[model samples]
Target chain A: MEHRPMIALVGNPNAGKSALFNALTGAHQKVGNYPGVTVERKLGRLALPDGRAADLIDLPGTYSLDAKSPDEQVTRNVVFGHQEGERRPDLIVIVVDAANLDNHLRFTLELIALGSPCIVALNMVDLATRDGLELDADQLSQDLGAPVIPTVAVRRRGLDDLKAAMVQGIPQHAAPLPVHSEHAAPDADELRRKAREIARRAIVAETPTRRITSQIDRVVLNPVAGPLILLALLFVIFQAVFAWSEAPIAMIEETFAALQTGVEAVLPEGFLRDLIVQGVINGVGSVVVFLPQILILFFFILMLEATGYMTRAAFLMDGLMARVGLSGRAFIPLLSSFACAIPGIMATRTISDPKDRLTTILIAPLMTCSARLPVYTLIIAAFIPSTSVWGGIGLQGLVLFALYVAGIFGAVVVAMLLRIGVIKGPGGSFLMELPKYQMPLLRDVIIGLWQRAWIFLRRAGTIIFVTTIILWLLLSFPKPPAGSDQSLVEYSAAGRIASVLEPVLRPIGFNHEIALALIPAMAAREVAVSALATANAIEESEDEDETARTLGERLQGRWSLPTALAFLAWFVFAPQCLSTIAVARRETNGWRWPLFMTAYLFALAWLGAGATYWTAVAFGL
Target chain B: MRLTSLEPNHPAYVESIDWNAMSEMDSRRLRELGLHEGASIELLHRAGFTGRGAYACRIGRMIVAMRAAHAGAISVRTGAE
Candidate 1:
């Protein structure tokens, strides 16, 4: 007997449940993994008008309590109080899309039959009414045992009524008797028959409407035109990633340069000055400058997802993915890796097939995440000119596009190899809902972009900040004797370390400085640019004005055109980030796959970079 | 007939699920999707390489996309034309 009740929000996928949850919880939310599963459990605090604050958990969305998928299993287990650490909810909030009530209510009636204290939030009621369909809430509430409240989640309408209905618990006698089942659940025919009867009594009017979404799908989902639009959309996104980020990137660099100049002018020459200017400002600035590009890339991804095109894109890629031994369900997790591999890897839980999930996880890191943008942009700007390719497309943009293509090709090749080897299995089914296209809301897009930018900046403020300070100390310690003509950093501990690593890395054209930068870079791929900026900045601290040259120009002057190409090739396959490996270890629940992933990626990166360097050198560049 | 053989945009009723043709998980998955006997299905769209492709079908209020390989495991009937 808990004093405060725990309410769980459960719903079918695409039912506006998350929207309602977001509205009710606002900012009082915690997102974490369910016990022994990677599926995210989003919990929040809600205050009732009766002055009691309740704990609210948003369970994973599923079509039924049939528990076919991991997400559905979690939802069913949590609701039934079978999941470890998840208490049976004191009350259940069943969210049903107002327009899709017939399909949604089958699951709703099942929950109602469970004889729990529950309320039906007929979400997206505004949409239903707009289509000339009116839902009599009281009548529906009478037909079903629980109180039914019409809600428009996104607009925040009827939320207070929802809150009131939830807190004012209905009498136990109000609910109908549970429906008995043969398969422990009704077959398709029985469920549909019951659902139609319920709809007949509950819903008053209906329009046999062919929604505008289906009309648009006619062209967009057309066999030939669908793939073409997808390609064109991707091309535009890549162009925008390059074309849109230029001004913001330059402004950030200039700001950092000014800040460095300001610090140098105010302080007397000392190690403290070096740490502040080189360690903190320059190192962190290098990575933070990619924020614009990351935001642009994620904006496009969110828009595609919000508009329902992402699922269709998966449908389109199914045949192509099958060749790589992946189901269409793998598309989402693979696409998600373009943002970061951590979430991408965790997202594989949705792919029910173990071998398919493992293969998806193995190749996810090769998707050219936004973290690699800083390093890629740095090398590309220095090596590839701003010249146009075909009247409008910048050479830089085309190269960026080519790099992404390289990653996709690499992932496919790797997945194919895995399928043929250790992870070999029969083809898995790809079954998923293709949600009707909706206009992506401005609010959701802004929120998505904000979250991405916040994550990037938070990383810059924490991990990059601490690591850069350590890098500065390593690059500064072991001072030379006062009279020695040699520079102080030449005698630093990092100097010796770099020299030792240089020989082994030289075949791929990495010099001692690049070798030193590679050490801290294992913490994060973007750290390579920050570390590179720090290493080069210390070398040029003697001539502060020349430091005005962009880190790209400095890298250009030191590393040859071949080395830059080799570096880009290395990064494409590089297993640089330790966090991704740690996450993979946790997700797979073993050390074997993560270890194998790291070993294979390292070999691929080293050999690939070596070949590129030698080939470019042979061309006499 | 197999689901892939169904005409696009034409309504068909699921008559029986071919359990032996697909994996057990797939058979269970299809039933979970309301694709068992008496459920209505309309092949809204098909996309992929010509012979082998994924089919997007509307079954009740849900639109599901599945590969033709998985589609071949399902049998359906249409009202007499």
Candidate 2:
């Protein structure tokens, strides 16, 4: 068997590299992480015209080989064969934005200087043509001493030519890689000058065409109207996440509920039945039900990213974010945190500065992710009345809105404090390119959404599934004495553990039941609701007489208003989700920051709960 | 005049850049984006409440956003000036 040639796709940011990679490789892509780094590794198989297949790796988008962030460092290391667990590519396909040739060609020139066999895919040729720029690929190929193929990656144009060029260019066997030191760091300024000259020579004709992007940016980035439009857009997204997802969420809930009921009927009245119904169905269902909201939030996020509007949103939010000592770049990640912090924390890779990224990671949990919704709604329904207050706002709606605002407010304060204390530094520079707007390909958007959904489901299947089984076993075994008056839950191991946890939680107005729920809730924050229902001995199925009253009524009958309020406050600051902590550890590359994050968040949760509990008691609520 | 002082939509040529005015990483970014002396540029948009937080400019067919502070480091010459 001849060795499969390894080909790499390299480009400056927004150079349409990924789209071209998707077009060439189609569905044969494997996404993973580089060992010891958070940068994503995308590998696919490129089928050659000749009966052979080559491995194609899509490296991260970068401006130059001169590394700044970890993401950029991965690209540089991989291209130079220094990256561990990655073989040196046999060929490099440099993707450059055709319209931005003068700027992109600078990086292309630097890559060419590496003395590696290279081909240039002049991407986004359609957009360039629309901008009334005509380019001669032959002249550009001659000027750079590399083959240039004009491609519109999103439209799958020129992919055949690009693939053919790749097959002919990539070596069959491993070639002795050039020493990265041999490049001696080509002067970037000189490369820019050379790139400009080459680009000028390649352009056969040009006309000053009006760009729709600038026209849109004029209104979108307007000092007066930009912020308003952004806020309105966010309002619509939040409304949609809750409103549009209602039907699907109900369907998911009913499906799981029915599954639990079916298991109870089919299985014998023993450990397996209890484990399947309560442990598997209820435990995972609590999290799986969040899928609709997550998908909805990600759809908008993916569209924003594809449409080239994410940067504009960031630009508009820069002013407000700056007030908190963060740049506009942090805005998108923080916004994503509203739907889920796991992705939000992952999104922080866009913040190149270490301090900026760290600070954003720490405060992301304060954004009130969708996981906390069930707990909040349960408590609010049980405690706050539905009567209108202050004209037409329902008191329940006001409380929910206040909780969201509280999270944002807490995030603001924590960000400022972190900037001044722990992660102190001059603010990171917010230098970004606002790419021209284009219609995102439907195929690309679907692929992106699928990847995000798969990641979320995998987490639910593995970590949440295992933790639920353990918690169920702890609650199920050592059956209460034959005539015992104690309920099964109160007689279990978890009940005994909750007794010890009760003392610590007492100051914050929590009872034995709340303590029992808090333990399993550590796996995922949404589990708090199911755990609470179990502690109260409330049947989870809908047909039971007790279940007819709903979890809200059960909570209302058992807990004081102050305790419910305190629980809400606790969740607002609590870093209770294990997955979030794990992701923070991965993204930061160590236990140090994630551990610090957990510690501070726990401290805040305790203090906030205590204060809210005491304040509610004082007010005689 | 500093690039930040250039009125929006006024095309200008970069006269000189005071790379010493900012962090080395930021200066590298500016240079990498072709914001050096002799590059033609036009201020396209100003964002934020004060309109001083971030500035958008066009350089070589790309629109780039940078904080006003970074823009203040480069000097530019409009035709009239």
Question: How do the residues A45-66 of candidate 1 rate in per-residue lDDT, one tens digit apiece?
Answer: 9988878888899999887887
lDDT scores in order: 0.80, 0.88
What's the lDDT for residue A461 in model 2? 95
lDDT of 1: 0.80
* Residue range A191-303, candidate 2, lDDT tens digits: 98999999999999999889888899989999989888988999999999999998998788778878887887899998788888889878888788898999999999999
RMSD of each: 4.1, 1.8
Index of the highest-lDDT prediction: 2
* Residue-level error in angstroms, candidate 2, position A22: 1.5
Model 2 TM-score is 0.97
Clash pairs, model 2 backbone: none
Give every collision pair in model 1. Answer: none
What are the per-model DockQ values? 0.65, 0.81
lDDT of 2 by residue, B1-81 (tens): 998889999899888888998999988887777787888889988887786668999976889898878888888998842
Model 2 residue A220 distance off true place after TM-score fit, in angstroms: 0.5
Candidate 1, A433: how far from true, in Å? 0.8
TM-score of chain A of 1: 0.85
